[model samples]
Target: MSVKGVTPIENTLEINWQGDQKSIYHNIWLRDNCHCSECYYPITKQRLLNSATIDINIKPKSVNVKEGKVEIVWDTDHSSTYDVDWLRIHSYNPRLIPLDKKLKDDDDVLKQKLWQVKDIKDDLPQVDYNKIMQSSDETDNEEAIKEWLLQIHKFGFSLINNVPISPTDTEKLCEKLNYIRPTHYGGFWDFTADLSKNDTAYTNFDISNHTDGTYWSNSPGLQLFHLLYHDGKGGTTSLVDSFKCAEILKAKYPESYEIFCKIPVPAHSAGEPKVCIQPDIPQPIFKLDHQGKLIQVRWNQSDRSTMDYWENPEDVIKFYKAIKNWVEIITSPENELWYQMKPGQCLIFDNWRIFHSRSEFTGQRRLCGAYFERDDFISRLKLLTLGREAVLDSI
Candidate 1:
């Protein structure tokens, strides 16, 4: 076992096993487990075998060390190799438990952080809705529109009632709101359009419990729907707070929370301009903010790809079952608030924070809607807050 040039560095340990020399750095054991697709399968939820799986019968054909890498040719028939970093980690720690354990623990911490709500009220400033609306007829009204936008930001959404009802007036209202956040997507839906038409843009049919733009890489944050004509039929809209749903999950199934936080489930759209492919981001179905306030829940059963990264298979199944149970609880009659928008009334809502659905209608129900970016709402809120401070100083 006399290996040539066998020299161990001051802080490193060198080992020569059957002509193969491996240098072990002091911190090699704590190296981050590379989150590569080959290393971790997002769908199978299994970690590939580490260096302990190396064949003992194989003898190194050649061993070379350069830079920070140890290159070796294992037996002519092996036909493959290993990286120095990988070898160092594998050799130093035969049991690959810490990386995965740390990931799971970090997930727990993130879940805790997400469930706690951040106090944003102190950071928000007040604005005058009437002043802002009046300015809409005057100057460009950038200042006024910014103030109205702040109200929407503070309330998550707002209802503008008492506006005169007319198809032409509805179009003007949308145009005015457009100044707040230019509608990335805009359309009008009525009874005439086949309610049965299964399209994302216009859905006249009775919708299910779902969020809009789950397929988008960054879904539209806000949605404004104006009721131009309501025949007073059975088309009432229902809303449920997603944060409330998260709270129910945290209280009901703690183990399921642990599993979801560890697993990385694929959520993507199969259409053109592929939306998002986020990795094991370690998010729970329900998360609380820093102040122990419920924040949001990432729920969409239809978009769930696979739950292979979960170390515990049984736990993964339990987590999904818990999600279904939570959905049932939130959508129950008691939890949902139903409101029918009258003609000339507008409803704006945070698409991310609230889940909305409409009941099947009997008569013609016409409505116009537009979407806005989340960041745009934040920007308008900030500007309005600053402007309000300036006005207060002038007083």
Candidate 2:
């Protein structure tokens, strides 16, 4: 029974959404999403009624539009009102055109200003710690904190100066935004030049440019490192915008780019000294969405294990060449950003987009840092900053 136009018949309610588009809503569905006091709690914004308890054949005695609201009076003597805008935003009509091409336009909503070292050399998106931090009793400074998060969300990295030079302070800072995502090493981990430690980060060695947690399926998103103590020399923290390097690779060598995007490189944490019992995960150096948009870049030459998934020698040869080409591009001086992190300075970077490393140093260089879940970071960003409307004006 196709609807001719917007009308409330015996059981169905058809809405004339746009010029020639009509969206149909059933009586039951309209009741389920009812914003009435009895149906939904106004304070908690939680639904009070159990969905299963609602009658499947429930009918509306009367339905009419008044002052931009759809008023519905059920046969059970319950009245409900729905704003037109709310219904429009949550409409699910297959024939109705979607707002955007992407299902979740969250990433696009950020309006991320991607860049290389040279792009941000003169004007790094740095903010003071006081802007983000809040007292126990006081509320957060909305605009300042929003700007701080906007910087990180846009640039894939940000610097926070005047952070407290204390253990777990980096982790505490993340609390202002979100919780710390725990890993095999532990949350709020501290690393220093220790001969007894198993990981290279614990030693004064020159670590090549790489993103952490390549072996895991759900890699950590945000990494915050606070240089609590760094009396050492030559231990300059190096960062490379892997996304920028990836674009370069995509343009120069499309074949290698294809291999890098398709081939699943094997990696495991068990191979690294004492970090054992971890599952082997296979992922491409470059991961793309279904629409062929670059989503993430996972690269760590040191952590990558010998992958025998593809027996074809030609495929294997091409995979190695792709990895080599990507590595060369990232390690190139033109892409590297060097910064000698001092005490009380915190570096926050995206683990999915930025490849980070440190140069070899002589003396002590203790740092406390923590990882934040990607989902939580994105969730916070949506609520605090302007949502889809932020990018709507650009359209």
Candidate 3:
């Protein structure tokens, strides 16, 4: 879109954008976002302008529309060039809807492809280890690694076959891309079913499908579970796409979904000294971004603490009913996808979307795993690919 006209005011700049729509931008905002060489470094694509040093009352000395751009000479003697297309995308006039809001309102923004057992049973995002882990050439390896990460971003989970049967393999794998998320449990951890630890994950009991670290405000994003050895009778990993189940709730039972979206549930670690557990963290089961898109799911029955928050008795009852229905839907037969993780196989899944559990087993079953922070994973994806657009395009 091209700029039709430009007008400089005392504190704001008004642009007559394409379609005869007017967009107003603050003078300070435009100055901070200047694309000039002095204000921004194009090589690193980073802004050099310091907001703290900027004059809050700065205004444009002269503004003119030329060659499809708004040329501005600031009162501070700094000249900047802004493409009309950039202004169109960054418009904040109340009369004109924001570009992102317009896209989302139009249902043009893509969402993750939620799947159940039957939908992706035969077509799981399974990749051969050699393509991602053992490519000889640097260019080939980068491409393969990008493909592997893309699979996780698109499907929320991926299986890499033929991984080395070592606990350190998970660590090495993290280093290949970025760093493994280090939390209270450390950067990398290995565990086996035993009563020595208080956590249910330590015992050979039928662990319910749950996401990890609901106790933390920012839960872990991606989880890496690599079975090093399993001489066990059973321990099949059960996965449920919580997002998929949530979509069902939203479509079929809108009231229950609304309750889940509104209410916050308490999750706790119960102060276990082993992992330095901190308790009583509150989180909503279904989280939505500011744009009203389902961004994450946090549900762990065992980790959930009592909801003692003061509320009307009727509302409390409604919460209980909604949670009960939510549990039933998530645990439904058709939603679960079970797989027996064998040695030399690593299952990388989006912890925010996939709820995982372990079936009770006998004998020894050892697993090594690690967590990757949500922002880190997203940053890596964007650096390697198209960031949010990559996900939108994939869906």
> On residues 234-304, what C-alpha lDDT tens digit does candidate 1 reach at each position?
77787666665555656776665555444544565443243343434534544456655544445565555
Model 1 lDDT vs. the true structure?
0.52
lDDT of 3 by residue, 1-395 (tens): 66777777668888876687888899988888887888887667677878788899998888888887788898888998887756765576744554444233334222356799899999989887766766433554477777777788777999988887887766687666567888766688888876445678877889988999888788899999888877769889888988889989889888889888888888777546655443445767889988798889988888887788845566787788887888888788899899988998889999999999888899998878889888888766654654454333222
Q: List candidate 1 segments past 4 Å from native.
A: 1-132, 136-151, 166-197, 200-204, 257-296, 301-312, 386-395
The C-alpha RMSD of each candidate to the native structure, in angstroms, is 15.5, 5.2, 4.1
Q: Relative to the true structure, how large is the alpha-carbon lDDT of every model?
A: 0.52, 0.77, 0.78
TM-score of 2: 0.78
- The digit string of per-residue lDDT tens for model 2 on 104-203 reads 4544656667677778888988988876775331554466677777888888889999888887666778787678887767877888777444668888
When sorted by lDDT, best at the front, the candidate numbers are 3, 2, 1
| Clashing residue pairs for model 3 | none
Better of 1 and 2 by lDDT: 2
Candidate 2, clashing residue pairs? none
- On lDDT, the leading prediction is 3
Estimate the overall C-alpha local distance difference test score of candidate 2. 0.77
The residue-level lDDT of candidate 3 at 244 comes to: 85
TM-score for each prediction? 0.53, 0.78, 0.86
CA shift at 16, candidate 2, in angstroms?
Answer: 3.4
Quality of model 3 by C-alpha lDDT: 0.78
Q: Lowest-scoring 10 consecutive residues by lDDT in candidate 3?
A: 102-111
